[model samples]
Target: MAMLNKGDTAALVCCSNGLRPSEKQRIDTLADILGDMGIRTAVSAVMYAASTHYAGTGKKRAEAFMELYCRKDVRAVFDVSGGDLANEVLPHLDYGIFIREPKPVFGYSDLTVLLNAVNASAGMETYLYQIRNLTGACGDRQREEFYRTAMGGSACLYDFEFKFLRGSGMEGIMAGGNIRCLLKLAGTPWWPDFAGKLLFLESRSGDAAKMATYLCQLEQTGALDKVNGILLGTFTQMEEEGCRPRIEELVLNITEKRGVPVAATPQIGHGSDSRCLILGRNYCLNLQGKTL
Candidate 1:
């Protein structure tokens, strides 16, 4: 897939939350933003279809996604927003469709389930980034990285500063997403296989103790043991005085014993300047060399 250029059409999909009357206006602005980047946008028919907090019923949301995937003109798909119910639509999705005709799919947060599932089950690479609440250049770097990675460019080309906590260096396919969302898929068929993968974990509004518990779940499930390395992204709201241990300490304690290469950076999470990461693609992380 070449980099999305002028006239390329990207489908705007709302899989989790429904758009309210006030938020609907932002669609036009989002279109203008994509247009400035030389891309055309098409809103999913069910983007605003409401069904008890979700944009639509599970089947309806699945249908919306399939419609975009099968479109001859659509080059990519972008979720309009993230919410708590994307996993509900997972069972209804046709994973075979993604395998047969894959396109770049962009989203994060609640969409983590879909991103990792499609890659693990359907064998298609997906992206992690935001489409909603994009202000003037707030997410431009992320958008550019998405374009580059989706176009088959190496993720290592982008400059990023990382703090190495353990190990020398490692390389593997990138996997994992929003820590909380990922934990939700534990017993499901969509659960990602983290073995021999570079697991990137990020989250918002979680404290050190809560984060440790989440990490413990992974540890007990044998997921952490199989991963070759761990990249901890921004743990927002974790710096409050009351938060226990701090994120760095928690991560080191959890991963150090495993001897997996561990690194942390605030450049790839819910932060204002998060960059796009290509899930299910191979990446080289050199802690000593200060590269990814």
Candidate 2:
């Protein structure tokens, strides 16, 4: 059976930034699209609330998220907003709600905070994805896969295209996302245990120097040495701007020394062509004859 069935409702919430007035129309359009796919959507009441750039206070946002999960008809929760305030909700979230009534929640970028937390807290698979991608330039491609999976025509939503950056035969349950966002969990109870995990990192924005600073911190904290491997997703901004040093140089410079197998995939991250990565699910490297 599919995780979501026809007529099931999906909740769209804002975990970080509030939606601008201009974006409401986009949500309506997305609702129409999902409707055509035989699914329905319920937008969070506080999705447009303004509290100094957040949709609402952390406690309120956390409450709203927990409420959605309690709904019997809602099979999934999709965070449609991203920014700096996501971590605020982390401290306020009721992990017990997630633990007792686990569901597939999806987000990326700053929502990485919730993705990792839900996985670590509840042992449920959370997705690194943006539901809003169905309205982007690559909407046709994204929407097709989403429809197929949502309608129970396919068992998998991810169509990954990855290449070995160095070494091979590395595979494990995935963790990590948005280089900087994952760091927000550093000292928190929500931080994922990277031991025996494939630490996947990506970024929508960040120059080489900024990435290096973050990477050095990862190394210093001994996180680099703990993970079995690292997967590099599209560094959108740096790649598009042709930034110096490049992400590969910075990542390889640090991870290579740790003897961790590394792989690269441009098919994920902030790109319009991006696909989903199910964190906490076992995945093996297989592209180009690579195997775990």
Candidate 2 structure lDDT: 0.85
Candidate 2, number of clashes: 0
Q: CA lDDT of 93 in candidate 2?
A: 80
lDDT, candidate 1, 70-137, per-residue tens: 88889989887677888888988889989888888988888888898899898898988776535435
lDDT of 2 at 87: 87
Task: For model 2, state the Cα shift of residue 186 in Å.
Answer: 0.7
Give candidate 1 regions above 4 Å deviation: 49-52, 136-159, 240-242, 288-292
lDDT scores in order: 0.79, 0.85
Residue pairs that clash (backbone atoms under 3 angstroms), model 1:
none
**RMSD of each candidate?**
2.7, 1.7
Candidate 2: where is the Cα deviation over 4 Å? 49-52, 153-156, 287-292
TM-score of each: 0.90, 0.95
Q: What's model 1's overall lDDT?
A: 0.79
Cα TM-score of candidate 1: 0.90
Best model number under TM-score:
2
